[model samples]
Target: MNARTGPLSDVRILDLTQALAGPFCTMLLADLGADVIKVEPPGGDMSRTMGPHPNDRAGTDYGGYFASVNRNKRSVVLDIKTDGGREAIFKLAATADAVVENAKTGVMDRAGIGYDRLRKIKPSLVYAAIRGFGDPRTGRSPYADWPAYDIVAQSMGGLVSITGPAGSDGFRAGPGVGDIYPGTLAALGVVSAIHAARRTGHGQFLDVAMYDAILTLCENIVYTYSRAGVVRGPQGNGTPVLCPFDVFRSRDGAVAIAAPGENHWAILCNAIGRPELIADDRCRNNPKRVANAEFVREAVSAWTTAHTTQEIVAAIGGRVPVGPVNTAKDIFADPHPRARGMLIEVDQPGDNPPLTIAGCPIKFTETPSGIYARAPLLGEHTEQILAEAGITDASKEKS
Candidate 1:
């Protein structure tokens, strides 16, 4: 890949985020060719000790969780508690194009590197902050000061209420959408801010709440609450709005079949050799199907179980919108996913066969994505970043 094009190729980001959301955001920017400097405390970010370790050693610092989101960025350790560390951060910020932080609302301010002060120092900077609930000005909520992880955000953000089985407790999404979604949104805001700063020489505050972002993906709940005056709960795999959208057990594994509109329902009926259902008054239209969803699911499941995942998919995939409930391995083998570069083999510095990680979901024809570097070791670029700041350890040696 003779690559020299990215959406944010020229942008430089000073990343002060930890855990999921902030790191995921910067990873996308890094994918788009930005120079992302990942900052940590003198010891390291706490997530370095997260689970799914590369080495089985009990106290190992390299977790796959950290690796997944922190790729394509350089790490530098600077303790905010110390004057020298704060000075170093200010120096780095002086020349940075954007700063992404996920500290509690006032933590950055306490450290003397809040957005207000930094923006004054460098007017065109993009200052993005991802916090638990929001800035203090946000609407009333009890957990404003309490630190939030993904599950907490999912619960309050309204995603938990409608997920999982119909009678069971609310379940969190399989992936950390609560974390990654906000980070992605914050990164977009950062880019927008960077763009505006480039034109106006003025920096604006960028704040993203995990709860708010997760709610954006749960638009259906708001509609159900408003229009139907109903509180939806764990519908399991089935959607309240569409019939036969649920996952059904198949001979091998499981398959998900959706027949949302009339045409799709008709196509699905035709594929299952049940065109009679197309004329049935109880199943003719979307509302009727939704109302009679249980009957429809059982009927579709009976047909789907007789065939393999591929066979069922072949019968009604594009025509009626159906899919097999594929596991991770299945996804890797799928033809379209491979062609789209959704799974790319990344070589761990010296590891053979390389570790395979998911590629960016977004695509661009002329400006394609390229990820050349792996996640940085702790403080991997401390000296280099300090050097770029035009100050070196030579002065500290005298002290």
Candidate 2:
């Protein structure tokens, strides 16, 4: 852990992202051993003000939102508008394998350090972007200049059209999948672009539009409409093609049980002490069960409601696909997370206790990757990072 490690340990990245989408993407690179230097503006990433800050740890230094996505990276404050700051960024970019940013369409170009200008400094430098719509470099969007956030992306991307209960108004997802999915895709694009650059000695500009990513994530909708003339709508916890694949209420809470397959349906039927149900004409095949969805749902619900989550798991787990709808407390108490190292504990600066954030799920058998550093305080490594970039302008940093 002491030594520089990870699959991308040798790769340096100049990160100019703020808020969730950009930072989340760079964080993935940082987790995988990329030396990601987060170049923040004088005021810091906007997420610094977002909270769940500990009562005893209130400060401008950090907050929960920033900490969650900005771990394992260094921060360097820079005002892109300043002459010296732009010079410093170019110097950093000269040495970086890639540059990633989520600024509006023309913000970077207006600052004079956009991909077109940066690639001139390093011909083989990969430039990746995450935007609400998309950059004109790839394809012009009608709303390219309009500002957007997670909600905007989710709404415009067609996710909100088919998201909630089949009869009720659609709901945005609890998590920022609108941003997170695009960020995840951006990370993959960056790495792939870099791989091609290493081979061709030339880099390219790539982007992930938040709206585009969401549409891609909901791909089934497109095909359903195109192939069947059906505009898919949410069926709440179950889908139109599957019966007994909904969230069932246990005595204590809820668990999702998907037993649409023939063998699985048989196993679940026997487990519920109603083996005869499986052979019934109305439930004999997936299509029939789906057609009689209400009957299957009611029968399954009746069984699940009589049992606690644990009992339901004991009866159907491993034999069929079943999982409790866990809360944070439940996840903390669960042994699976611990065994898989899903939750990582990191040190906090003040009197607050150590904070636990999600760990990287990507596992490499030969190459090691993980969180190695806590989220940096604003401008905490300004001087150090500038020095490493061979830019002697730490004095010009305002924050």
Tell me the TM-score of each prediction against the true structure.
0.93, 0.97
Candidate 2, residues 1-399, lDDT tens digits: the string is 244467988888899999999999999999899999999988999998888886665443778899999998999988888888888888899999999999999899988999999999999999999999999988999999989899888888888877888887688988999999999999999999999999999999999999999999888889999999998776688888887788989999999999989999999999998899989999999999999999998999999999999999998889999999999999999999888878999887667778899989887777778889889889989888888877654546432
For model 1, the superposed segments whose C-alpha errors exceed 4 Å read 1-4, 55-61, 137-142, 350-353, 395-399
RMSD of each: 2.5, 1.6
Every candidate's lDDT: 0.81, 0.89
The 10-residue segment with the lowest total lDDT in model 2: 390-399
- Candidate 1 displacement at residue 162 in angstroms: 0.4
- Maximum-TM-score candidate: 2
The TM-score, computed over Cα atoms with residue i paired to residue i, of candidate 1 is 0.93
Clashing pairs in 2: none
